[model samples]
Target: MKFEKESCSVKELVDDLYLAHQLLVPTHLRFSKEAEGDLFIYTDKKRLSQVITNFLTNACKFTNSGYIKLGFKHLRGTDEAAIFVEDSGIGLSEEEQEKVFSRFFKQDEFSQGAGLGLSICQGIVQNLGGRIALSSKLGKGSRFSVVLPVYKGG
Candidate 1:
């Protein structure tokens, strides 16, 4: 798929996603944002938004309670910005984390949806010339992060 890449504000995208998914947070869960200022990146907004939405949706679904935080910031001296979603909910084991991005992979068989979200997200990030990362521990929580090149000048 061809992505319509462009220079866009990371803060704006985070704000939009936060607003779009705020009401969807479970009553037992609290949502927050860690993005402070307007950081810019050169990428496809719609595709990146999809990746983030998937992160938020999974965070809400797996998290029984606690907080889900969305964050974005520049990696100092790296010319890249990291966008991440962290949840204090059910996380993955070492084996699970290794295969979480595989197509049709699901931690819970009973969970809804076809297990294609993360795989698609990885593809999207890669197409945008970025890399996606994940950190988690069983019974703790998980964090999904995507780092993209920051938008310099035109």
Candidate 2:
């Protein structure tokens, strides 16, 4: 499938998140917003949502109990924003963190994913002049953060 990039407004993006939440309501989902600034970014709209969705999906799959939080914060002294999707689920190991974004890298031995989700997220973020990172502790949780440059007018 061909993927096309599009511009998205922060408010609209949150709306999309709500829609996705509605679809997954049966999964006992919870959302908490902690955005501090105007959450706007210049990137592929569809792919960006895909990134968040993938994170949430993975969280739900690994989490047996506890809450998932989608948080946002703008870094000071820069026109960059950080979006974090944190989950209180079974986290990854140090070695897995190093290769989480690598192509075809799956932590779960029984997982059937092609392992391109995070890889695609990395490429999309890089293409938009941004970076992606993650932090996790086994038996604790994982937090995936994407730092993207804000789109200013020409």
Candidate 3:
């Protein structure tokens, strides 16, 4: 995918995501209260949106009914911003977490998808000079965060 970086609003991006997935009602989706105002970041909007979209899609898939939160926080004392998508869905185990981002890796052998979602997310974040992380507990839920350096204008 082609990537063109420029100053973009995180709020708008997150809003788009929330709108797209908002109808999952019993599975309420919202932006974190801590995410306020317009936070600008330099990156490829499409690529970043794709990564966030993937995270939300997965969240919507695994979560039968609960809440999914999308938000970003400017990391203090650091030049990075943390964009996270969290879901109250089936969580992954420690062993599964290790393999979740591996190409063609899926927990359930019969599940849909080529198991390339997280792997692609990793590459996209890395391409944007960022990294993705995960925290999950089996039967509880999962949280995925992508940390990208905040863009400072030249």
Candidate 4:
């Protein structure tokens, strides 16, 4: 996969999310938004989308009842925007959180994919001069937040 950075519009990014939302409906998926202001980021759109998609897919796999929420907010005094994907599913432990972003690390047997999603996300966010973090409580849920800088000239 090419790792070059690219400028992407908020509308375009949301469009991809909308498509994912469609696929999520049959699984009883739902999204709650509290996004204000324009959402934009300076990063590879494909890679970022992959991150969000992976998060959402994981949420669906773990959450059998409550909904998954995607939120967007801007950081003041900086060109950074925060995107959060939260789910009311089986959460991870503190130890698990420590290695969630490590390559090929999987929390348990319930997880799917090659276990490289979070690792890829960390690399992508770092490549864009950003950071990714997570918070969770076992049996409660988990939230993955990606902080990315907005493209100032695009």
Q: Pick the candidate with the highest TM-score.
A: 1
Tens digits of per-residue lDDT, candidate 1, 1-154, equal: 8789888999999999988988888877889999767788888899899899999999988999899999998888888899999998899999999999999999998999899999999999998999998999889999999999888877
- Which digits, one per residue and each the tens of the lDDT, describe model 2 over residues 86-130? 888899999888888899898886886888888888887777667
lDDT leader: 1
Output the lDDT of residue 64, model 3: 71
Q: How good is model 3 by TM-score? A: 0.89
The segments of candidate 3 whose C-alpha lies over 4 angstroms from its true place after superposition are 24-34
Q: TM-score for every candidate vs. truth?
A: 0.96, 0.84, 0.89, 0.84
lDDT of predicted model 3: 0.82
lDDT of 4 by residue, 18-47 (tens): 566766644565666546767666677777
Worst 10 residues of 4 by lDDT: 25-34
Give all candidates' CA lDDT scores: 0.91, 0.75, 0.82, 0.77
Model 2 weakest 10-residue run by lDDT: 1-10
Candidate 3 residue pairs in clash (backbone atoms < 3 Å): none
Error of 3 at 138 (Å): 1.3
lDDT of 3 by residue, 9-122 (tens): 887887786777566434254434237666778899999988988887788778776677888888789987888988778899999999999999987778789999999999
User: Which 10 consecutive positions of candidate 3 have the poorest summed lDDT?
Assistant: 25-34
lDDT of 4: 0.77
TM-score: the better of candidates 1 and 2: 1
